[model samples]
Target: MPILEDLKEYVERATGLRRPGKRKVSDLARARKPHAVRFKDDGLVPNHPRWPLIIYRGAFEFDERHDPAAVIEDLFEANGWGDTWRDGIYDYVHYHSRIHEVLGIARGKGRVRFGGKKGRIFTLKAGDVAVLPAGTGHQCLSADDDFLVVGAYPPAGTYDECTTIEDRPRALMPIPKVPPPRKDPVYGTSGPLSKLWKKAK
Candidate 1:
């Protein structure tokens, strides 16, 4: 079923049907302080030491007239995050050792575990966005059948998936070195991310 879903997404993307908007628009619903959480290196998942994962609740808004997923993709693109994709989170625990990631909930709700086995679990709904620093483990625990998420990466680092204890040793060196995203996916240069990340550094 996952493979078939992947194929359907591929076809939609290839035909440019997945994104129907060609113009830039501002649809941010509200501005609020982001909820930041830090997870320690849980032995297996070398969570970032300096940066805390950021969660922006109800960061964007859409109505029946608009396509929420496309709006999320456009916002990320406008803020300099690229390599956008539309899909559900991987069901198993995993992480990116070399790059940071941002996920914007587009159409449904889900329970996701952040960090590793000892990490926290959060419920994410449409309009919510989560920004993950490199080495931060995450997994989708459960979701509604209509759940959809839009993901993107900052331009600064290489994307690498690490899921085993065997990958831990090599993952350490790059976890702290990965550059912070130039702009927050939800806000531009002046966003809280710029200040918070710089302060952490």
Candidate 2:
């Protein structure tokens, strides 16, 4: 089946099969892998933006019988995130100044640094997911041979690359204009991000 067709079914099954009050994505993941999340505070990077860098652990535990990357990608798309792609993390330092980003670690493991050189570092493996707010820099410190990431942005999240503060003034203006997705990419409408992001300046 085509990806769109599969996406259609995924959306229907997810929305149609939901209970009155439950996160379908979380419930779905619970049936496969144990899913978890973490929220970060304002780091070296500065923005009045309302979202945090979300990390979802065991977001897509894959088995020989199940493809986690594909599942993660689908979930993201169904949640109004788009511009999906798959690749290893870029070795050089870079950040998207125009839009936020989400990265799903589909296979293998790696160390990634976020928020420029002064930022924090994280270890990501298969089933891990990281949601990066705009203007935060990141780079792959190291990785295993099979490391793969599925990345995306919210609907129409056209992006640009920035390596330093030179991009800040131009970058900051759009931050407030970027609206949050109706549903959290990993969780659903009632997720923490829904509340935190609304509080963003």
Candidate 3:
């Protein structure tokens, strides 16, 4: 079923056609301070050394009139992030070696561990968004029955998942080389991501 869903998503993205409905992609976002944290390499995870993981709490204020998942997709697409997918976080620790990622909480709530075994655990509810730089490890600690996450990536890099110590050698090369997204998935050029990431570089 998951494979079928992924194929459908790929087709949708390839065709540039989203699920049809009256989408409210207007002003549903809230201006919030982005909380950023840097994580070190745990030998296995090879987390990004320079870029910090950014969290935007209550980034969007959603109501019954809006589909939270669709709202996230719209916002991400508008900001030049593509290849959107909807699913829950993985149970085991994993990182994307070649590209940065943004995860938006669209339904229920979840607790995720960022970085590796030494990373911090965050409780994310609906409307929260987390932007992870390349090679940042993430694992799902817990989630509600209805928990759902909307994830997307920038057009700069290819997507590859790394989970084992053996993958570290191959992952390290591209971790730091991955280019930062020009716009925040939730906010455009004026968002904190622009200045924060720029200053870090």
Top candidate (TM-score): 1
Clashes of 3: 0
Predicted candidate 1: what Cα RMSD to the true structure?
A: 2.6
Mind giving the per-residue lDDT tens digits that candidate 1 earns over 1-201?
446545655665576665544344354446868999999999999999899999999998676654677778878888899998878999988999999999999888999999999999999999999999999999999999989898999999999999999999999999999988889888888789878877874
Q: How are the candidates ranked when ordered by TM-score, highest leading?
A: 1, 3, 2
Model 1 misplacement above 4 A: 1-23
Backbone clash tally (model 1)? 0
lDDT of 3 by residue, 1-201 (tens): 346546755665566455322234537879999999999898888888898999999998787754567678888888888888888999999999999999999888999999999999999999999999999999999999888888999999999999899998999999999988898887887789978877874
- lDDT against the true structure, each candidate: 0.86, 0.66, 0.86
lDDT of 3 at 92: 99
What tens digits encode model 2's per-residue C-alpha lDDT throughout 26-124?
444432222323223234345334556667777554545335555666678767777777778888777776777889887789999876666678899
RMSDs, each prediction? 2.6, 6.8, 3.4
TM-score of each: 0.89, 0.74, 0.89
Select the stronger candidate by lDDT from 2 and 3: 3
